[model samples]
Each structure stands twice: as C-alpha cells, then as structure tokens.
Target: MKFAATVRAAALCTAVALLPATTAGYAQVEARVSPEFARLFATYQRIKTSYVDQVDDEALIRGAIDGMLASLDPHSSYLDGTALQRLNTMIDGNYQGLGISVQMEDGAVKVISPFRGSPAEQAGVAAGDYITHIDGRLIYGLEIDQAVEQMRGPAGSAIELTIFRPGRDNSFDVTVTRGVIELEPVTSELIDGNIGHIMVNEFSADVGSDVRNALRDLQGQATGRLTGLVLDLRRNPGGSLDEAVALSDLFLSDGQIVSQRGRNRQDTIVYESETVYRGDVAEGLPIIVLIDEGSASASEIVAGALQDHHRALVMGERSFGKGSVQTLLPLTRDSALKLTTARYYTPSGRSVQEGGIEPDIRVPQLSDPDAERRQRLAMRESDLRGHLVNEAGVQDEALERDRLDDPRFQLTAAQLEEQGVTDFQLDYAVRTLRRTAGTVASR
Candidate 1:
C-alpha cells in the first residue's frame, strides 16, 4: 500500500511538471485527476475487496511497482532480495553456478550469454537459448530469482536444463557440472609474433587495474616489443560504469570518453580521458578490440570511446546495445528501483539505444555452425518491447539487415574446429594484426 501511494505521488508530480505554464493548462491539469491514475486506483480497490482468493499486501504492491517500471523500458526493473543480492555478487565478480547471464522473457528464462571459460560455455551453452525446465521441474512462470536459485548449487554439483534453441527443430537437455565461477575480469597472454592478447570478461570493481596488470603480464611474456594488442570483450555483459570510463581512459590521452543525457538538465554529464589513468597504455601499438552481440553497457562504452577516437579497430559483430544507465534508487533497506536514468552517447554523439556499436570490421564467427541461425534469432536491445527510441531516428531497414546472412561466411563450426581453430574471431584478429605488423615493418 505504501509503495502504491509512492507510485501515485510520483505519477502526479510528473504530470504536473509536464503541464504548460499558461493559466488554461494549469486549470486543466488541476481540475481533472488523471483518468489513468483513477482507473488504476479503482482496479486496485476492486482486486483487494472482491477477489475470490486473498492476496497479500506486499504482493499487490510489488506487482504494482513492477508494472510501473515495465511500462518505462526493458532494462528498468524493481530489485530486491535475491535480485539485489545477485547484482552485488556480479559486481563483486564471483558466484557458484553455471556462470551464465540470463533474463526472463514472457515467463521463460532466456540466456543472455555464458561467462567466458565457464562450464556452461564449455558444455556448448550459448546466447539466445531459452531455458524451459531446470532439472526435472518445470520452471516456466517462475520468478527469475527462483529459476536462478534452481540453477545454483555447491561447486561440482550437476544440473540438467531443457533448452529450446530457436534455430533447432526440437528442444534438448544439457547437463552442466557447476563450479566456483571465479570471474577473472581480465586475462592476457602473448601470442605468436609477440602479439598481446587480453580478454576482459566484465567491467567489475578494479577492472581498470586488472587490465593494466594483464597488459604488464603480457608485455613480460613477449620476447621483444609487442607488435599488436587484442582486447577481447566477447560475451562480456557490462558492469561498473566507472570501470568503463576507466578502461576507455587507458587508451585515450584526452577528449570525451562518453556522455550521459537524462530528462533533467542536472543528469547530463561527460566523462573524459586522462582523468583515470594517464596516456595510452599500449601507445603506438596497433590495438584491435573484439566485441560481439553479448558485449553490452560498459563494454559498449569502452569500445565506442576507443573506436570514435580512432584509437582501436573494433572487430567482430555489433555490440549488445545497452547504452541506458540504470541508477539504483533505494526504496527500502533491502530494495531499490533500478530506474533508467539516462541514455549514453559515444564521443561523436551517437546513441547506442537500439543501434549498437557497429564494428570497424564486420567479422562473422565462422567457427559456429549455428552462427547464421543464431544471428537471425538473437535478441538485441532493438528487439526488446518498450525499448527507448534513438533520438537520431534509426531506419527499420538497417535493423533488418543485421539478421541477413552474408555470403562471405560459409565455414561450419565443426569444419573450423577440425582445422584447429577454436575461435575464428580471435584467430582472424591475430592474423589481421600480423599483417598490419608486416606492413609496418616493410615501411
């Protein structure tokens, strides 16, 4: 009831603020109570008084709150209890589970992506898989928290999942052995030709520091000067905003990294380089940033900044396009409103709302046989119902083209695997870097 009252008050305040300053507009706003508000209150009263089954006050309030946020956008939501705890755990960068990021879609659990090097990924679980059942129990219509809880267990425990892949003709079951999902936010290795490879799993706390350390480690492994650097952000659903800015700052000497704009003037803010770390860490080294459909939010921020600055060549598929900033407004001791406070922009003022970061080089993952089919079924921010519109006004044709198959990519996952290519994208990036190094050496 208290939550409903707060919602009503907030709605009223928003309506009043939108009213024109003219006397007629003021009179019209004050004279008639909002019909929508009245209808909502009436419905609430009817449900409370005349429902056949008794409904708890907390359930009613929470439902009301969820409905309100759901109407705003896909990313906005009500967070409390397990959901809140999970968010904290993600930012902390460790959990005991299958290490997959998921969301509820139409009452079914949808896999966003499995964490890099996790058991789920090793078992071939992929993005765009719909999880229908957990173990032997039907999990449809269950809360996301409940479904997530079912997936989590002690390390080494096994869980069976019934996955409905959009491209597949029939559903299949996958058994994964859970483990201590210790998220190594940044990892680096020296590849052939002294190329440095760094993979950023997530932008958690101290991610900038972790990346810096990774760079140092890779440099140590190299026999001579590092010829190039590959910064991998594939399957990285973003985390801390500050860490994004911090990581971007590592590649830029100066200029704006990213900017956030909200309805209120006070909410607009710009983040610049040279504010976190100093000059570019890999200065003068050809840098390639690898991203895909799973790379989102903070990942986009880093990629967008580096791409816009011409500091890095962004390769792979388009990013996940989650540019909206969610400010956690505390409601109670354990609960908060994960409200969409602002939309972020790249240095060139491009909004990443629906149109995600387009790669400088559109390299398809030739390794996966299902890549083409999955791309067609993959859900981006643009596919989400009630998603925010880009202020620049995007053409529907552009969004449609993203799913169209390119004749250039024809290799199957099995074919590539047989050729000793575990990851086509990374291999392509390394080859590209090697070629670039050759050109520089010849010059």
Candidate 2:
C-alpha cells in the first residue's frame, strides 16, 4: 500500500496493448452528501456568508467543492465540470496536448519526461526539460499545476512551447501539435530465441488474467520449458493493489506477500500468497523482475515480495520507494479523496516509503551515455534500506545487498544505452534464469 500504489500501478496496468480499466466502488452510494457532513458544509457556509465583500457565488461553491474532495484523499478529489471532462480525456489515453507528464519543481513548471513517440519527444523533449514560455507568455513564475492547465486544449490544436533544456542557455521554441497519446500497458513477443518477454508498462485491471493468457500464449509457441521469463517493470508506474497481489500469486505460493498498517489499531491488513499458485503446474519456474524509479507501488510489492521470499531475482536500481497507500475515498458529486490511508511492508516487514526496497543485486539503468548525464545521477549506497513501503523494522537485511557494482548483476542501463537496446535489464534477467535453469525448490 504505497503512496502512489494506485496511481503508479495504474500506469503499469496500462497493458492495454494487452489490457483496459478505472476506480470506483459502492455504487449504491449516491453522489450527494448527507446532513452528517457538517464539518465541511458548515465551513463552506461560514466562508460564503462571513467573507468580506460579496464573494463570487461560483468561486465560493468551487472552493467548497475543492475542500470536500481534498479531505477525502490525495487521489480522490473534486474536478470541476470542465476539469472532469479533461480528466476523462486523459484517462482515455488520448488527448490533444503536449505529451508530457509534468510536476512542480522548485516553484517552476518542469517537465518530468515526454511520453515516448509523442509530439514532444519527436520535438526532442527530454525527461528533465523545463518550460519557460507558453505561447510567448513567460511561464517561469507559474506553478506546475497551473502550467499544465495552460498546456491542454482541444484536439488537433497546436501549442508553441519555449523549453529551457537542461545544460543549455539559449531557450528554443518547439511547436507541437496536440495529438492523442496512447499509453501502452503490456508489450510481449519472443526475444533471444524462444524466450517470451512481457514488458509490462504497468499493471491495470484484469492484468492478472492477461498475464496468464500471455504466458499461456507464449508457452504454446515455445518448445523448451519456457527457457526464461523476463518481466520488464522499468519505468512501470504500479497500479491496483489487488492486481499487485493477484499478480504475485501468479508466481508465488504459501507465504506472506505484503502487509499494511494504518495509524489506527484496527486498520492493519496482511496480504498472503496463496498455497495453491496457479494450479502449481508452473512450479519451480524461474521469475526475474525488472524494476526502476518508475517501477513503484504494486510493482515494488511484486518485486519485494518475490525477492524477500526468495521466489525471484530482482534486478535494477533501488525502486521508486512509494510504499504509502492512498485510497480514493469518494465524496458527493463526481469527486473523491485519494487519502494516504496505510503504509505497506514486504513479507519480511520492511517499509518502502522514504527508502525503497534494496534489490538483491542492483543494476542501474542509465538513460544517457554522455558524461554530463552521469553527473546528474547518483545511486547512493546509503539510500538502500529494508523497508518495503512504509512499515519499519528489520526483516531480511542479510539476504541480499543493494550491490550496484556487484559482478553477479551485469548489463546495466548504461550498457543498454550504449548498445541502443533498453531491454538489457530484461536480457540480464533472462540470462540469470538461463543460468539458474530448472525448478526452484520452494523455501
């Protein structure tokens, strides 16, 4: 139950290239608040009535709406009517706008990374690019959220963005046409001769079955005992917790997978791997998990649980460390609150918040080859920890080391960048499975 488990996992569940999905429960509950919502409603009334000069009714009501949604949780929140429509478009995975996921950094609007193959990337927008102008209106002082509101608009429209590319002084304008960007979840195919690779961009609804079907399809084609299974979770923003647990059960058996602890005494919950794991026919099959900073939430749960239980070999840099669970608490109207409800722990009782789980053998992905790029990166050995999500306490520190420079873990992101094949991480995983060929005795 990491902070971004739902949002992050939602990104990975994007297996739409392999699957499709949303978040909503308790359909019986109406979109209207009860009289019992006194604390919030009363505050709204008081603000509207007592505030200085006559307030704009619309603004006051919107403020009240925002407040109601904010109180629920971080993921759940009130989207104004117009905002709601845009959200629909965003989730639909297609929209006319700059294809970039942004965040507020240092009080300025900064681009996290341009979506691959999008207009932005075609325009050469990199991961850490910053926007200094929006159609010539200086954006240096705008907040990231406010800047995002300015960047989106009708389909087929075009926007000129002045980007402050890192390491360069002269800003440049890249005119990008707004187009529909489809986020892919799962991409599978045969590689390295008969080895079926499932690059799960993220986990989403029903991915459990999709994964099973994918495995079955690949196994149907392969002659050998599925020589290797490489699960590429690099940059995979994890999704649903249930999906994470279900996915874990696909490979694990008879052990604690993950657990959660809330502030209150009654809120603790533990998720355990089932005794019967997918008919047990795939028993002893090797699983190699690939992870990175973008691989978080449900992704961490899967990797951590497998690694902790000695079920799989986790390869990659330390994970994104997003172990706080945010539950979307629905409110009246079409809004909801994504509140951080619980903190999760690995099978060994380690929290992944602040400090993410340390991989048994660390392999870092270098997206750049230039020496300049290396200076910006730092995978400190001090950053390693046993925490799975947010739950604290030692469990299995001696089991593995966050060995970034270990000889056992080869084919890092930097090497992949040099060879021009980002799949080197998975390649390493496949190689490991090939080396450790045979049934894995259940511990």
Candidate 3:
C-alpha cells in the first residue's frame, strides 16, 4: 500500500511537471487523472487481491511500469536495480560473463552479436541463435535481465548454454568459460600496403581519445606514411552519443555532424565538427567506414556524419536503423526510465528510423557462410512492434533492395577461406583502399 501511494504521488508529480503554468493547463492535468487512474488502480487492486497467488505490491507496480514502457518502443524501458548495474557494467567496459548482447523476442532470448574475442565468441555462439536454457534449466520465458544475470559470474567460471540456431536442424549446447571482459573500444593495426585498420568495438568513454592514440600508433607502426584507413564498425551496437560526435569530429573539420529533434523545440540540438577535436586527425588519407546490420545508434551517427561530409566512403550492407535517442531519466537512486526523447538526423537531415543508412558501396560479408540467411532474418528498428514511424514515410522496397545478389559477390565462404580471406568485408575495404588510395580522401 505504501509503494502504491508512492507510485500515485510520483505520477501526479510527473503530470504536474509536464503541464504548462496556465490555469487551463492545470485543469487539463487534473482531468487526465479521472478514468485512467481509476482503471489502472482497479486493475492493480484486482490483481493484488483476487489473483490466484499473492501478488506483491512491488511486482504489481513494476509490471505496470514495464507494460507502460513496452507500449512506447523497444528501446524505452524501465531499468530496475539489476538492470541499472548491468548498464553501468557495460559503460565501465569490464565484466565477468559471456560477452554477448541478447534480446527477448517472442519469449525467447536471442543473441544479437557476441563481442569481439569474448568467451561466447571463442565458444562459437553465433548471432540469431536462441538461447533456450541456462545450465540445463529452461529459460524460454524468463525476463531478459534474469537470463543475463544467470549468465554472469566471477572470472574463470563456466556456464552451459542450450542454443537453438536458426537454419539448423537441432538445438545444441555449448560451455563458455567466463573471464574478465576488458572492452578495448579502439583497436588499430597496420595492414598490408601501409593501410591502418581500426576496429571500434563500441562508443564507450574516451573513444575519441583512444582512436586518436590508435591512429598515432598506426602511423608509427606503418613502414611508410599511412596510405588509407578503414574504420570497422561491424557488429557494434553503439554506446555514448558524445563519443560518436567526437569520433566523427576526428575526420571532419567543418560543418554540422548530426542533429536531434524532439517533441519540444527546446530539445532540438545540433552537433558540429571541429568542436571536439581541432581538425581531421587522419587528414588527406582515404577513409572507408564499414557497417553492417549489427551497427546501430552511435555507430550510425558516426557513419552518417562521415558519409554526409564526404569524409569517409561507407561500405558493406545497410546499417541497423536506430535513429531515436534514449535519455535516462532517474526516478530513484536504483531505478530509472530510459525514455526515447528524440529522433536524430544525419547532417543532410536524413532520419534512419525505419530505413537505415544505405552504403555507398554495397559489400556483403562473403566470409560468413550464413550471411544471406541472417540478413533475411535480421531484426531492425522497423521490425519491432510499436516502433516510431518515420516522418518521411520510408518505402518498404528500400529495405529489400539488398536482397538481389550482385555478380561481384559470387564467392562462397569456403572459397574465401581457401584464398586466406577471413573477413571479406575488411579485405574488400583494404583492397579498395589500396586501389583508390587518394580517391576517398579527395571526397
């Protein structure tokens, strides 16, 4: 009862805060509490008193909050204490677990993508694999947070996972040993022909600075001056927005990077280049940005900025369309609302809500044998239920434009492997850079 009263009071406060200062606004706010509050309270009371089992007040309240957020969008949700801690752990980039991002789809936990060089990846947990159980216990209907909690443990711990991979005949189990996951956001190396390959794992803290350092290190390692650079953003689910801006600024000297517009005009903000960093760190070097269906949010932001500014040539398949920005609004110390506040835009004012960023050069991951199958089944923002509609009304045909196979990408995974090409996308980018070294830099 105490918690219910607290919830009511919080709702009232939120309503009052959203209302204008006029008396008419106050009347409208008061009127909003009439039938809606009664219906919600009635349902809560019914569930608490007449349910088959004794339902606690916290459970009822949390369920209500979760249901409310579920109605908004897939990204907007309530973060409980455990969820908050997990988010913090991701931001800190150090955790002991199977480093894979998973989402609940139709009561089944589906793997998004395993982090690079994580135990899950080392143990061969591919994306689109549905985790059916944890340690022999069925977890088909468990909450995503609960399922993730069951997976996390101290370093050197082992956990068994039952995976149901799509396109496979039967389910299989794999044992992954947990270790300390130190996420190195920016990792660079000098490839053949003095080309710098920098793979940004995520847009975590100090990503810009880390990238600058990586570029310097790459330049130092290169036999001669660096001819070109490939910024690989494949399978990066995005992180800090500020870091995205900073990373984009490293390649652009002038012009707007990205803009975000919300319901209120006051919430509109524009980010520009040369604000975070002075000038293009890798100035006059051909830059190719590689993106795929796994790249979303901050990754899209950086890709969009560089593409719009003609600083980098965006290659690979279309990106994961996630243009909305989620703002964390704290209600309590351990609880918060991750609300979708604004829809971001590229410098050219293109919103990648439903229609993601189309690559300048469409390159498929030919090294992955299941690339075509996964592309057909990949879920983006538009696939989610209750996702916000794009204002520009993106055509459905644009989403399927890549389905038609190109003659250039005819090589099979086995063929690529036989040719000693592990990553087809990166190799293609490297070859492109080698051939067109001064071309993208002149863009």
TM-scores, each model vs. reference: 0.89, 0.70, 0.91
User: Model 3, range 1-443, lDDT digits (tens) per residue?
Assistant: 00001133366347525744333553465577575655666576577678999977667767877898888887787886889888888888999999998777767898867888899999989766789999999998888899999999998989999998766668999999999999888888899899999999888889999999999999999997999999999888888888999999998999999998988898788998889999888888999999998788899999999998888999998988889888766666787777787899999999999888889889999998988777776777787778889999999899988667889999999999999999999999999899987665533
Candidate with more favorable, higher TM-score: 2 or 3: 3
Q: Rank all candidate structures by their lDDT, best first, as comma-separated numbers.
A: 3, 1, 2
Error of 3 at 221 (Å): 1.4
As for TM-score, the candidate ahead, 1 or 3, is: 3
Off by over 4 Å in 1: 1-36, 404-408, 438-443
Give the Cα-based TM-score of candidate 2 against the true structure. Answer: 0.70
Supply every candidate's count of residue pairs whose N, Cα or C atoms clash at under 3 angstroms: 1, 39, 0
Candidate 2 off by > 4 Å: 1-78, 82-101, 109-145, 153-177, 275-281, 370-422, 439-443
- Model 2's alpha-carbon lDDT is 0.61
Candidate 2 lDDT, 281-339, residue by residue in tens: 35667667777655667788888888887877777766656676766433335544446
Which residue pairs collide in model 3, if any?
Answer: none
For residue 133, model 1's alpha carbon misses the true position, in angstroms, by 1.2
